[model samples]
Structure formats: C-alpha cells, structure tokens
Target: MPKMIFVNLPITDLDRSISFYEAVGGRREPKFSNDRAAMIVLSDTISVMLLTHDFYSTFTRKPIADAHRTSQVLLALSADSVADVDATIDKASSAGGKVDPGPKQEMGDLMYGRSFEDPDGHHWEIMWMDPQAAEQGASAFEQA
Candidate 1:
C-alpha cells in the first residue's frame, strides 16, 4: 500500500475552507468529515484535514497560534507546469484567498513558483519543476 499524508490545520470556518480547497483541486471526503472537521482530498495520497480550533485544541496542549499573525508552516504542492501554478493561485485569489505579494520565481526553464494565503492566513505555495532544464544547467538567476 502507498503511504498517505494528512496535513491537519486549524480553521475558523469549515465550510469556507472546504470551498476554498475545492477551488484548488480538492474534493471533500464526507466519510471523514463532520461539523468539526472536513477532510479535503488533494490526491490519492494527500489530504488536508481542516479542523475547528476547538476540535484541534483537543489533540494538543499548546495554545493554537493565530495563523493570521504568525506562520507555522508553508504547505506546498507541485504542479505539472508553470501555467498550472498560475491558474491555481488565480483560482485561490478569486475564491477570496490572499495572493502573496512576492514576485513569482522562475528558475530558467526549470522551476516556477507562487504563493497564496487562505482566509485563515495559512500559507500555500504552488510550484513546478523540470528535470531536463536542471540536467542542462539552465539558470534564470543573474550572477553578480
């Protein structure tokens, strides 16, 4: 069996988070979801468990850090192409997510990336990488 990953996050609104994830290629798994939590399946092996602050608190003794004020993690996902990275992030912004102000990164023809923040301010990065470009030592960076 293939290993699976569940990234658990504390969210203020379950429904809104689920909607946002759906816009970015996730499907809700009702079997593992409820009023307190929603399981958003991103891929066959990747899922995001959106839990209410109260529900998430039950699993940890530490106080939940406000994602709006401080970042604890940056959730990243790979895309098939640079266009996909832009499309996904654009969808996220249209769904009320905050697009990061940073400039997009383009590493020659090898890699491209962008970032966005969910309503709860959880950071997410969308990226694409090409092995052939890397193998040829192509670079977009200017040497000083």
Candidate 2:
C-alpha cells in the first residue's frame, strides 16, 4: 500500500486560505472539505489540510503559533530541473506568495536547489539532483 502524508495548518479564514492556496497550485479536495476545513491536494501522496483557527484549536491544547510573526514549519517540493524550480517560484510570487533571497547554486555536478516562502509564511525549497552524481557520492546540494 502507498503511504500518504497530511500536513495540517491553521488559517485565519478558511475561504481566503483556500483561495490563496488555489492560486499557488493547490487543488481543492471536495470529498474532504466542509465549512471549517478544506483539503488542498498537492499530489497523490501529499495533501495539506487548511483548518480555520477555531476548528484547528480544538485539535490541540497548545496555542497555535502566529505564522506571520514566526513560522513553525517549512514545506519543500522537489522539481525535475532548475528551470522548473524557478518557474514555480515565479508563479508562487505572482500568486501572492513571497520568494526567499534567491536561488543558491552548487558548482558541482550533483545537485541544485532554490527556496521560497508561501503566503502563510511557510518556507519551501525546490531541488533537483543528478542520479549519476549521487552514485559518485557528491554532496553539493546537501547544505541547501
């Protein structure tokens, strides 16, 4: 059986959050959605649960962190190539997300990566690697 990953996030407004996510390449999962929460599907095995503040608080006793002030998590997505990573980052920023400083480049033959932040302050990293370089034990992109 294939394993699935669910990331739950607290949002100020369910509808607003859903719209922002949709603009940044997230698709709504109607089967898992309701008035207080919506499921943002990323891939077959990955999904993000956007829950209203009131609804999310019920799931945990600890206080929810203010994402605007500080981030509690960083979500990374891998791309097949460096150009693909850059394109996604551009789309994210155009859709109301924020890009990090810039892309960090590794001068070796192994890997390359770029990072950005989502509208909700979630950090994201996009990366690509050469299979041949991995077999040679290259560690160029490991630091980023």
User: Model 1: how large is the Cα RMSD against the reference?
Assistant: 2.6
Candidate that would win on TM-score: 1
Model 2 accuracy (lDDT, Cα)? 0.77
Q: What local distance difference test score does each model get?
A: 0.88, 0.77
Tens digit of per-residue lDDT, candidate 2, span 1-144: 699999998877778778877876789999999999999998899899998889998999999888667867767776777778778778777777777644575545567777776556667777777776656563534542
Q: Residue 118: error of model 2 in Å?
A: 2.3
RMSD in Å for all candidates: 2.6, 2.8
Collision count for each candidate, in order: 0, 0
TM-scores for all candidates: the values are 0.90, 0.83
Please identify model 2 stretches exceeding 4 Å from their true place.
101-108, 134-144
Minimal lDDT window, size 10, model 2 = 135-144
